[model samples]
Target: MSEAYDLFVIGGGINGAGIARDAAGRGMKVLLVEKDDLASHTSSASTKLVHGGLRYLEQFEFRLVGESLREREVLLANAPHIIWPLRFVLPHVKGMRPKWMLQLGLAIYDRLGGKKTLPGSHRLDLRKAPHQAILQDSLKSGFEYADCWVEDSRLVVLTAMDAEARGATVLTRTECTALERHADSWTATLEGDGGKRTIEAACVVNAAGPWVDTVARTALGSGTPAHLRLVKGSHIIVPRAYPGDHAYIFQQPDKRIVFAIPYERDFTLIGTTDMLYEGDLDRVEISAEERAYLREAVTRYFRSGVTEEDIVSTYAGVRPLYEDKAASNSTVTRDYVFEVEAEGGAPILSVYGGKITTYRKLAEHALEKLAGHIDVPGEGWTADAPLPGGDMKDGDFAHFLWEASERHPWIPPEMLLRLARAYGTRLDIVVGEASSLEGLGEYLGGDLYEAELTYLATHEYARSAEDVLWRRSKLALHLPQDAILAVGAWFDARREAATP
Candidate 1:
């Protein structure tokens, strides 16, 4: 007989993690299972902004924009280390959106959201040095607005960490093969490396992301009236296009907007083409057309002219948007919708079409939808609580970095900063009283050390070298091919040593 949990969340993306964390904090016995690594899909492949969706306002998605804008502040307050304010430079192209229209839109955006800590929008002189030197000569004006940059994947991991700390069971690389509904509960069969197990739960949350429909049809064995529009969005990483910390949001002649963001300290991240995705879900890749489209989008504004050869790496993800019957893929609503179906008293809530910016609110609403069916001991509490290492004193990242340096004087400044930014107050756990770099164990490569790898494996659910090198940290971009190979060998050796 398996122990019955109050809630079983199916998925490991931001929404599932957030829901698990929230439910656990509310005193509900929760279990969350992910089919793959956390945020291995859409959540990690975002433009990585915590903005109000300025473009969404053009489509009259005022409610979504307002909620997202408010959530930006909430997320920033809760996880200051991974979420911080970022300024955007929107260069005004001739015969595109008029300058007054841009200013009016920004003003409405500023007013729609409640009180904010980040600065409001204003005009920009693109003819100046940093802007003029990089942008095309014809672009002499622009608008600067406030948004935020996020460590998107880390946010998902931290949420899961918080859920675990709050006594929630989080299983990664585990698949929910089938779910049997009863008059009072659900018996779920979960398969993982350790093998299969049946877990009983009072309810289920199908936050399966791209596989939401499949989970509903196969696992739950229910066919409700709902459809998903899979849209593939691709991004390209190139050598830093300009010498500034700020990012650019350029308007194209086709009325679509593309962003050029500063990434990985030495690369400029440009993205995202929205095309109807009808291909295999597991094998999403950047198409040549998308690559060329993005290059042209950036080249139109930059004097240096972006080209295909400049691309260092590319990534593509399929967004599981709710079927809104919109005219085109890009116009599909980013707002989330929940379909809660209960048969024989066992409820399954399916999440559809959500953005990274509004995940917290989505979780809150999810719990609200489960109110009468499940017993929640407490009200919403995640908004005020910091996620895992995010509890820097007063949420001041700069002060936290300084304090980290003061405590671990032996650690290198660059390494210490990276650790501080990534782990915040949790740096000491990884350092583990190590007084020197040598004390941290063998240097893996680049900034990676053996001690850090151990910490990731044991704490952050990193199973493969790719998990640590790419998703956990962008070391894949920094480390040489040989170094990456060495890291993989180290993982294999570690697993062998652990084998009994």
Candidate 2:
């Protein structure tokens, strides 16, 4: 008989990774499997905000809003490098929701969340310099509120890294092919580049995001698994539409809201159409209609019009919202629902419809549900714990950056800042004893160097250039085509040389 694990988790997105980290911290034996790179899908494709869904207040989802808002503070503490404060400017327009209504909504929004270190909502003068320069002349006033920007994909990777460090086994590019449940435990077959293997676990977490229902049915027989409503949300990246760090929230004629956010220091990110999705899940892309919709949506509020020629990149992902049969796709609950099957055998907890902001709470709640079925050795302690690189002195990232500059005088300021954001306190491991850029390694592309690539491969489970360029970081957007190809070639040559 093989050694049994206390928990077996499927998927490597935020929820799965969060669960793995939580379970491992509890001293439970855990094995987490991902079919592809971490955050390769919906988790990475988010609007990248650690925020309470302000619009949810209109849907009477006060509980969800409060929970998400509380988690934002928790996440900011856990991963300060990848998550930081972002202010949003919502301009008040005529023939729309009245200013009183907006004020009421913002007031409720400000209070629903717990004690906030972030600044509260206040009125904005759109006719002022930066706001006036960006907005249409007709727009006179607006409201400014606080949310946060996050490197969404990096959050997943860091969670997985923390899980592994805490004594859990994290297997990326590994698929849970088969699951056999017994009265006391579950036997799962996993396949990957490592071939095939089987493992036993007392409990199972089906956190496969979009494939949640499919995993449930596959594991528990075809007996009417939980229904999932996959809504497709797409975003377009254009040259920076505004000069300020603040983002914009535009209310559409159809009552839907679209956000135009500053992205990558050089681009504006406009997104998210909430259309009912019924297409290929793996190959989701911004459709011509969605692009036109987003372009028109932003152009309506901006003094400068956006055209197709300005689009630099585009991406789309399917959100696995728990089906509620709402009047419209946008009305569907962003809240998560769990279905635990433990009546006749080992428990299998299937997670459905969770957002990035509330993943930590969701994981804590999942463990609470499993408490009756298994021996939980650890308590819920993730709320205040810092992720791998987040434990800077006094949790102040700015101070940490200044200290890093003093320590590594030979490194370029831009490169140091980028590394500081990506690795946080762990930048020490990447820099090592190198006193200069030449000692660090050959420059691959952008700020990517051989030393950084080695660190990613050895520590972060990065296998290919795509994992480094896209998921691990957004270097793909900054690096030229030839530079990207060189990175790919470098990885290929190294792998070929190591092959027998």
Candidate 3:
């Protein structure tokens, strides 16, 4: 007989992973399946901020901004290792929104989420030390506020990890090919390396992100109307643009804002252009126009103008925003909307449009919606639960790093810092009992080692070199071409050895 589950979740992105985690903790027999790796699409392709969407305040999305702001605090406390506070410098332009309006918005933003640990918004003197050398001479003053920088893909992985640890089965690179809803249950056909299989689920949560509408159609017939306005957002990476740990937010003449954030220690991450996306969802890439737009966006604010040659790499992803018939793609609401269909059969709740910062709350609310149709036990509990390796003494990353350094004195400072930041209290698990550099097994260029790769395969569901270099750690940015090839070879050999 096919295995029966209480709930079946489609998509391994943040939303699906979060729901699975919450449901499992509530004693539901849960399973989460993803067509690709976790966060391979929209979730991984964000501007990587856990902010309240300061720009959305202009559109009067006060509720969304406030909820997101509050969730930012919750996420930071739960996953301190992967999420941290980042200060942003928003310079006031000559013809842009007035300084008074900016100040008022900042003041509202500071209070909207209630009292928090992060420092409140404050005024900045652009004529001062760091800003004078980095920004243009024409920029006199601006505002500085607190947001957060998140390891986008890592956050998804850790959430899924937590879910798995709580007894939720997570199957990556597996696609849900068919969904047959009966009067009281769903028979889902999943295909992957293990081949096809059917499982019975009492309820379904469609958290397929960009494929939400498609999944809905698969379950509710082809005529189910689409609800998503695919908005393509792109970003460009370049060598360090400035010296400070702070990021810059530049205002465009079109009323949109662009960010240039310090990324991966040695690179500046600048992005995000919003355009109506109508092309392929599987392979999303930055258009030439988007690349130019981002370069020009930053050029107008910084002393050192960005050019085509300055761009080292670029990425783009589609935001499956809920269609509100907004005038512009940039102005569409980011708040999540749920479509529940339980009239004739078991309930299949489809999720639309939400940001990473609000994913936890989205899960709780999703379960609440399900509770009306089915029996759901337990109240919301993920708000205070720490994700894998996120627990530390008072959530102090620096103090944890210091203790790690004392224990692993032989490890290089740069390597230790990276490991500490990525793994938090789980650093020992990656390094094992290695006493010296050679104890980490074969070195894979940069600071990567075979031991870390083994840990990922054994515990983190990593199956390819791209999964390790790009999504898991971004080591591709630092490793040489030959070393990268070697990593691929290692995976190929491992797979071949397991083939028998």
Global local distance difference test of model 1 = 0.90
Q: Please, what are the lDDT tens digits per residue for candidate 1 over residues 252-291? A: 8778889999998989999888999888888899999999
Runs off by more than 4 Å, candidate 3: 223-226
Models 1 onward score TM values of 0.98, 0.98, 0.99
lDDT of 3 by residue, 403-464 (tens): 99999999999999999878888899999989998999988888889999999888888999
The predicted structure with the larger lDDT, 1 or 2, is: 2
lDDT against the true structure, each candidate:
0.90, 0.91, 0.93
Best by lDDT: 3
lDDT of 2 by residue, 1-500 (tens): 66589999999999999999999999999999999999999999999999999989889999999999999998998889889999999999999988998999999989987698899999988898888888889899989999999999999999999999999999999999899989999999988987998899999999999888778878888632567899999999998887888899999888889999999888899988998888877888889999999999988999898999999999899999998889889989999999899978899999999999999999999999899888887689899889978998777999999999999998889999999999999999999889989887988877778999889988998889999998899888899998899889888987898888
The runs of at least 3 residues in candidate 2 whose Cα sits more than 4 Å from the true structure, single-residue gaps closed, are 1-3, 223-225
TM-score of model 2 relative to the true fold? 0.98
Give the lDDT of residue 488 in candidate 3: 97
Q: After superposition, how far is residue 114 of candidate 2 from its true place, in Å?
A: 2.4
Q: Model 3: number of clashes?
A: 0
